[model samples]
Target chain A: MQLQINNKTHEVDADGDTPLLWVIRDNLGMTGTKYGCGLAQCGACSVLVDGEIVRSCVTPLDSVIGRSVTTIEAIETDPVGKAVVAAWVNHQVPQCGYCQSGQVMAATALLKQTPNPTEDDIAAAMVNLCRCGTYNFIKTAVNEVAGRKEASL
Target chain B: MKKFLLTLIAIIVIAGGGLFWFVTHKPGSPFDGETASAAPADLVHRGEMVARQADCVACHSTPDSKPFSGGLEMGTPLGSIFATNISPDKQTGIGNYTLADFDRAVRHGVTPDGKRLYPAMPYPSYVKMTDDDIRALYAFMMNGVQPQNVPNKPSGIEWPMNMRWPLALWNAVFVPSGTYAAKPQQDEQWNRGAYLVQAAGHCGACHTPRSVTMNEKALDEGGTDFLAGALLDGWYAPSLRQDHNTGLARWSEDDIFAFLKNGRNKHAVVFGSMAEAYNNSTQFMTDDDLKAISHYLKSLPGDPARDGQPWAYVAATSATGNAGKPGAQTYAAKCGFCHGTDGRGKNEWIPPLAGAASSLISHSESQVNVTLNGSARVVTADIPDAYRMPSFREQLSDRQIADVISYVRSSWGNHGGPVTPEDVKALREHTDPASSNPIVLQMR
Candidate 1:
């Protein structure tokens, strides 16, 4: 299988049914995308497939054969991704940062679709789970990128 | 005159005998020589308070599991031992236990059936609880808790190692069966901190190093190792002692209070096992109690020779053409954006990597764990944080991660030393990403 990741195409031979998480982590050794629960319940393995946030742990490798896969490594290159990462750092939002890659991806995706996201939009879009419970910072970072004055709960 | 002298002699004898009895005779139980009385409603309330002081729910309850249902598996040198259900269920929990049974179990580390419990239960410190407190604890466990039928899981310890008899002997040597007596020299706040740290908080359980026999090296401030920190469950619980880099030497009393209250301060945020402690126990502490804890912790002196010179931040000039260096490019590409080329973080939120404890500590476990698995969430007051360090495990090779870490450690006057790829690989194999559902206990 040939997959485009971070704007680079790679040829990989793995089972079609193999989850993209394993393909990225075990086969390609791109571990920034974590395997939190393996179940889609946690968004730790979130990655952008043609700019849509998908739980890669459940998304099979075959699903991304033709689609462009953008991960945490590449997310920074995108304007929205860079802003989200910057906002995250400025806000000091991470603790035990296992779920952060997915968080950044989700936040980046949210910002791209809705440049001026309200607290409610953020609440609905940025649903990735963080064990460190960094949601307040997430909201703040989102608000900062959106150029809002008010804080989100 | 003779009659008067004889009466006086009889009175003196009776009084002397009474004094002797009072001094020598040990009270067997709270109920001894008193008629059986029902525990008052207020006593049950007090019992609940006592249980909270002990922080029983932290270990006894699993995340999203029933309170005190006791399924949390604790790792030991022998094997893993699951916490038992103490929720007063007759079939599986401690519902069938009498007050005497509770006392023996809590203080003596013995079960109703004469079986010895593993020392992991913290009964060594609990033995210091007063009889009244124990009675109240019994009342709380019996009356306050909702009984659950969750069956206790048997330990995974192998046969000879799993045998309970040795623990009795171990207890005899290590456990002190007496209530805490306040030191006359210390102030009330210090005494309170001492009581809470030594008994209820069980700070030594994780922070204090263990003996070859798996016993806590020290139980009180008298021992240098107490609260000096030990590695547990893949993360190093840095010393609560006064050690400059690794301990609380640099933390002010206010810093300590703030960390306890808010779960994060300028220096560091609570993560790993401590996140659970903050979520369930420390955040809810009274302000006075938090102050007292800080006061007590600050009294501990640091080892100048071991802790080395106090860390001073040194400014770093950006070196051009450093991309040729093994880790320099990785740092520039990966870390420098957040940490900066100077290695000083942007603000209080983005902790400075230069002289940061995570990079400066002798143990690289924390760094490796965070770099590999990423941190758990840092929730304060039920609000999740927004910023998070993404895991670099997949993006960077073990060698790359090690190289970058080494660069961070050696640079900006950080003296923590270099970490090897082998070290990174070992930690990566053992550790998992921080769970989103940290053990947040909701104790009533």
Candidate 2:
């Protein structure tokens, strides 16, 4: 299978049912994408499949065979992704950092699609689960990326 | 005879004066002459660091609640006791508390109004804090934290149990009132580690066994059972002692330090209640402090008889399982995919079942709890892991859960012993699924 990840093309041998998370982590060695809940309940494996946030753990390799997959590694290349990453750092959003790649990916996707998201839009779109309960900081980071003042805790 | 009498009188007078001085004199605080306004910024910053070391935020605040506006419910054998607001709110929090009141409450577990506090506040450990630390803590609480007027919640303990007077007597008997004394026999690093573990870090609050009165079975190194390990909140905090199997005997100092700093090492990953501590507290500690902790923990001896034999990995030939046994079949069908047919999990991400503490320890509560309800999300450095264990409660029957656990325990050189169906049922009834929202405290 051929996949476009981080603006680079790669040919890999994996089963059609193999989760993109494993292919990225084990086979391709792009371990930035975590394996949180193999069942898409947690968005720890969130990635951009043609600009839409998809839970890579549940998204099979075949589904994104020819699509552009943007991960945490390449999110910095785009202006929106760069802004989100900067906001994340400014807010000190990560605690354990295992779920951050997915979080960053999800946030970037939200900014790309909505550009100016309301609290309700953010609440609805940013569904990635954080065990550290960093949602408050995450909201602040998103607002910062959206060129708004940081929300008070 | 006259000369002898005069000499005796002089000796008596001198001895009496010395005794009086010893009894009356106490260490004066550096801030004794200064007012709260005169407290230096550096001192307040130090105090904030100390607060983090003490993990004041972990119990004092709830997720989405203002920091230090305590409302976290602590479960006790008696009942649930809510942590009181320690924020500087004038009406509802500790804003009115004088420094002396704060001292007494923190070190002696006595309120300003002479009410006794439960040991759940861990004043026994706090008693060992130096006067300087106490002064700084008071300064920080007064100045650094934002005042929240959140009213305190009353404990659910009934009648006589709720009566606080007995706690005064309990305090008198069990609580030691003084700062930590450095042991002459140990090095500076060792003593620092001791002070941090016994006082500020309050490792014993979870690790040490409690008496019927809920007093820690031992306070410090003087007691053999100190840090020997205990069961609390359905999880067993493994011994910090040097037991090869259940404790840090096999782990080097680096391993301990790594676990504290990074939350996971080659041995195991932090989960359950410890994940919270790692997320909020230990990960922020300096490398020197983490090393000191490791040094102190490693010095403790393990209980050989209690820990049993050290574990060694025994490889299984194939991914396929033994047929006919329902327990083996259950393991193969349900657990084998992720855990592997051999029972050894993949790397640090998926913890290996072979020689895993949850599977090998005598305490079966954690095993049962995780198996039934699955794990709470492990978020370190704000990054949630991509993988988590899904809840098996709905999918597996109590008997099946018991069988699978028993099979795991007996197999792969794991010797945690058998768990009965009744045990699973009891845990099933009491425990709830791990909430995706872990207790995250935003300590300023």
Candidate 3:
């Protein structure tokens, strides 16, 4: 299979039925996309498919061949990714640092889709399960991302 | 040629002398790995508190795992590493540790013979512990704990990477110590609880989140989310803060004290990390300390908005009967045999299901998971007879499991939430029922 991962094309060896998670982790050596639940019940395997946050655990590799695959690795490359990471670190969004990559991807996509998200917007975006239950921080940081002028500017 | 020879001889002599001096000056430093700190009373007392604050017993003293002899295989992305014996046994434990040696191991994350302890040991969190606490912990281990001859099994952490020294860098950025200082603005009980929860107990070790560096983001007061809640291992340690959904939003000060003291109260029941806390740490605490913890917890005002619609049990359609639902039927089949028709569990033995804290807490996850997986049999000293809630994995399907849990939650005065089969299935995949022969070991 071929994928435009992080804006770079790469040929990979793996079954198509396998979730994009294994391809990123075992095959691509990008350990950033964690495997909290292979079923996507926990959004720990969330990544960007065409700038929209999708649970990579449930997403098949073959389905998104021509589409772009953006992960935590390339998150810093995108403009929205910068804002999300900055907000995450500044407000300290993560607790166990396990569910956060997905949280960030979701929040980034949310902000990209809607620059100013309210509490409800954040709640909807943060459906990912954080065992540490950093939901409060998640709400606070995304709120900061929305209020900050940099998000739009 | 003559000058070059003379310089070489001078360099060699100085280098040899420097090595000799360096080795002698740094007492019990990394260079000298053979030192031992004998068990002293002071060391023992301190170690007791340090261990309590760290909740070391929670994981180490499992049903089969010897107390501090460390056979409980804690799970991680890096595979399982059984907790090690810190008992003073010369053959099987750290009876060979010196003060500085223990200090390095405790606060610095270095082991007695100069190796790094994995973050799983919570050295990253302990790195914030003060020197005094470290010394006291050393004293406690050296003196307080009985010696055990059980050898520590090697951790499953694979080759070359298992080397401990690299953890030094992980520590440098993340760990910073200086015992908790109370907020002058907050009253005494709150301060006391904060101190106990953060420092003496190091509750945040499990309760707080970590940064990318794997260090606890904020140790105490500076972070609003401190002691709020975080997930560790398989269980979710609910927020110590007064949040509505999964925290003590509606719990009173007295309720907190009761839960900590006896393990069950009207608002919540002790399960998961909390049960261990009750079995080992909180249950052993003095009344004043419990009150103080309660008082502190009470000071945290819950976000009424998020805590949302306070739970009120709707009267059963018949007022005195189980609703004719799959949940009710499943409850009768597997659970009602022990829990009673009313959902109130037996005292000290089978924890009551109705109106208990876990069921009352808005988030139905813990309630559903515990019912499906059953509880880890509590084992304390002198009480060899322990009771375990058996796993329903094979006997019940996800829908059946969800119905049974939902029946318990909604039946009596408890109002947790209506659980879905999806929730049960998710937990079923993630969790394995606790062992009847839990990893308990004995220190000599």
TM-score of chain B of each: 0.86, 0.88, 0.75
State the lDDT of candidate 1 residue by residue for A83-145, as single tens digits.
999988988889999999999998998899889987777886777788889988889998999
The lDDT for every candidate, in the order shown, is: 0.79, 0.82, 0.68
Model 3 misplacement above 4 A: A1-153, B1-50, B90-92, B112-114, B128-131, B159-166, B186-189, B209-217, B304-306, B318-324, B336-365, B377-388, B406-426, B429-432, B435-444
- lDDT by residue (B389-440, candidate 2, tens digit) is 6688998898999999998887777888999999999999988887766545
**Alpha-carbon runs more than 4 Å astray in model 1:** A1-153, B1-49, B319-325, B332-348, B388-390
Instruction: Looking at model 2, give its docking quality level.
Output: incorrect
C-alpha RMSD (angstroms) for model 1: 16.3
Q: What stretches of model 2 exceed 4 Å from their correct place? A: A1-153, B1-34, B318-324
Candidate ranking under DockQ, highest first, comes to: 2, 1, 3
TM-score of candidate 2 chain B vs. the reference: 0.88
For each candidate, what's the DockQ? 0.03, 0.04, 0.01
Ranking by lDDT: 2, 1, 3
The CA root-mean-square deviation of candidate 3, after full C-alpha superposition on the true structure, stands at 24.6
RMSD of each: 16.3, 16.0, 24.6
Candidate 1, residues B1-444, lDDT tens digits: the string is 999999999999999887555433332444334433577889998887778777789888977678899988887767899999999899999988778778878877778777788888888888777788888988888888889899888899998887776666687689876877888899999998888788777778888888888788988889998888888888888889888877888889998998888776667767667777777778767888889998999998877776766777766554633445578767754566445667765344345677777776788888777777766666667765433456777778999989988888877778888999999999889777776553457554
Q: Least accurate stretch of 10 residues (summed lDDT) in model 2 chain B?
A: B23-32
